[model samples]
Target: MFVLSSPSGTGKTTIARRLLAEDADIALSVSVTTRPMRPGEVEGRDYFFTDRAKFEAMVEAGEFLEWAEVFGNLYGTPKSYIKAGLKEGRDFLFDVDWQGTQQLHQRMETDVVRVFLLPPSIAELDRRLRGRGTDSAEVIAGRMARAQAEISHWDSYDYVAINDDMEQCFTRVKTILAAERLRRARQTGLVDFTRELMR
Candidate 1:
């Protein structure tokens, strides 16, 4: 599993979307949430929307690989079919917050690769949020207030991509993913290949 985390305006989601489109080997881990579905979002593809009661029941049943409450909404990675996919050599990409990343790493330390994205500057972050024109000023201020705390965990991630330039950052993340796939532990089938060659 690979994770990309960043403050709200840092463009991590965009990077993850492009990465998923370009890479055939990796699939995004769609999360389940209690938040209302937005206009363009499709069920299961974007998020598995559920009522608060059902979301809470899932937590009680321990159905989540990782879960967290963010800005009053509960979001979780369901432990659905991921184990079988992993055994078949599939990669999963997670676009999550730092809290979610922490929970995931705690549960799957060896299987996890964590990456954090940094906005170039506070001013730039503010600019990006304002430029989106999607959120109200109050909401933007709330996100800005929380950004610093979220970014404080940067040291915990294995890699950090500075979002100074979109293309450069995407290249760096893709390169990281490539290198991670080649790691000795992840290439378990290589043992059999090597032994066969020796025979």
Candidate 2:
């Protein structure tokens, strides 16, 4: 499990999309959400949309690896989906906030690689949010306030990339992924290969 987390306007989603497009080994983890699906989102591809009751029921049954309530909506990662993928030696990418990242790390510390993206500056983040023009002034203000709070948790992540330049930031993130993949503990076949070489 690889996690990319940042404030709303910090380009985490943009970088995640590019990484998924370029890397064949990693697939995005589609979360289950109680939020209504927006346009252009597929049911299983983007999220597993469900009603509040069903989502609560899932929680009661302990179906989630990590779950949280964000902006009045419930979101969770299904353990069954990720467990099967991990056993097959597949990588999963997670695009979540600090809360979700913390939960994921607690539940799967050995398998989780946490990366936090930072904006060049608060001013730049505000400009980026305003540039989108999809939110009202009030909402933008709220996001800016939340961004400050989120950035405070930067030290908790395994890696931190500052998004001063999009291409450079993406490159840094890719480098981190590559290094993590080469970690000795993650090399499941290394012992067998080394034994064979000695023989």
Candidate 3:
């Protein structure tokens, strides 16, 4: 489980997009959400959109690996989907908030690799949010408030990246992934490979 978390305006989402586009080895874990889909977001690609009631039903059925209510919307990672992918030796990139990442790490600490992304500064975060020209002032205020709260959880992550420049930030993230992939326990066939080499 590779988690990338940041405040809304930080380059986390954009960096995540670039990772998915460039790295064939890493696949995005499409989460299920009750939030209304954005303008260009696809039904299944961006999120598996559903209603509150249905989402609640999924929760009741214990379908999620981690779930959280964010700004009145619900988001969850389906447990079965991710487990199957892991069994097949696949890597999944999770673009989730701090809360969801915490829940996942608590449940499977050994499997989780948490990365926290930060903006250059609060002022820059605010500016980037405004640059979108999408949200109203009131909405932006709420977002900025939420961003501060999210930043407070930054220390909880295993790796922290300050996203001042997009490409540089992505390179650092990719390096982290490469290092994690070589970890002894994460390399599933390493034991056999080592034993064969010794023989």
Off by over 4 Å in 2: 132-138
- Clashes (backbone N, CA, C under 3 Å), per candidate, total 0, 0, 0
Residue pair clashes in candidate 2: none
Task: Give a tens-digit lDDT track for model 1, residues 48-113.
Answer: 999899999989998888999877999899886567678889999998888888989998899999
Off by over 4 Å in 1: 38-40, 132-141
Answer with 1 or 2, whichever has the higher TM-score: 2
Write the residue-wise lDDT of candidate 2 on 97-187 in tens digits.
8888898988898999999999998789989878668889998888788888989899999999999999999999999999999999999
Candidates in order have lDDT scores of: 0.91, 0.93, 0.91
- Provide TM-scores for the models: 0.89, 0.92, 0.88
Best by TM-score: 2
What is the lDDT for 76 in model 3?
93
RMSD of each: 2.3, 1.8, 2.5
Error of 3 at 90 (Å): 0.7
